[model samples]
Target: MRPSLTPVPLGVEPMTRSILFEGLFVHGLPRNEAFEAELRQAGFDRGDLLPQYPLRLFRQCMDIACRHFYPGLPVEEGRRKLGHHFVQGFTRTVLGGAVAVGMPLIGPVRFLKKFPEHLRFDTSPILVQAVEVGERSFRMEFRTGVGLSPHFLRGMLEEGLRMTRVNPTLRVVRHSPISFDLHITW
Candidate 1:
């Protein structure tokens, strides 16, 4: 469980003495319902084997991850595949676990979206700069302000990354955006 402190809004100046970053990949997303209804109406079966969550609450992290890995795919097609794969994965896992995996799945899903997984970079503000050298990565900025503590700052920086899952043939990484101005062309 995350400690009792509140998280700073993203893009706001951070309130810590140092900064860090981490990389992540995610899985086990639940499907949302509105999309399910839409899918059924469109003649796509909301397969009994792969029941999904409501659309407004759907966790499309894996979908976003796909777009990152396969950058050239059309957005709409990627979106569809993402939804399909999410349901397949979600169903397969839960079915394997059987009744034991009941309601608790939702708890973590809801919690993570509200809060997020964190990944930290090397913990030093002085070495940081905004540069964009990689595709799908962005230059993010942070500053130490009020409510700043070494531990909390570290946690905040690490949020939003999910790197623990070990199955599936996909990969995702969330590193800090490279500094575009720091030229190192070889």
Candidate 2:
């Protein structure tokens, strides 16, 4: 099913750091002038990125990445691909360098266990609840004002797990305008 992209309540806005954009463009799609130009049109100039930005701008950039790199895929699939790129790029950034070095050493289970803590690196207002369901598996629930689609989170989690050298399977059991539940196993 397609995840909802409902807007957050009025007067409430979610925010993130510029490192995310840098992750996607500089680390994810490095040296792609076309992608850079597209972002420049969308009011995000990679040359002069902000330290923090609202979720709306982040969504716009994600849209651009989806269109630029995965146009042939379905919308959900495209966002998933973008999510993978986000993590891949994010880990390459100075902010995420620690994750790159540490995730593999700790492995997937530990990573998922510490996922909520890792998310603290972002300034976005989000609440995460993680529960271990079985060996090598866990369920994570997220509540956020940011309207991020489930596919993106799924892809991001999947990629993060893969970085630890384990093949992962993820599914969204429930989704709402403000919250979602993701189950993952490797």
- The lDDT for every candidate, in the order shown, is 0.30, 0.80
**Across residues 1-186, which tens digit of lDDT does each residue of candidate 1 receive?**
313333345654432111110001112323556544554454333353222222211223323444454468765445435544333343344332342244244332332233222222212122323333443233332322121122222222222112112111212222333211111111
TM-score of each: 0.21, 0.86
Angstrom error of the Cα, residue 146, model 1: value is 35
Identify the leading candidate in terms of lDDT.
Answer: 2
lDDT, candidate 2, 142-178, per-residue tens: 8776666778888889989998999999988667776
TM-score of 2: 0.86
Range of the 10 consecutive residues with the lowest summed lDDT in candidate 2: 1-10
In Å, residue 136's CA in model 2 sits off its true spot by 1.3
Model 1 regions more than 4 Å off: 1-63, 95-186
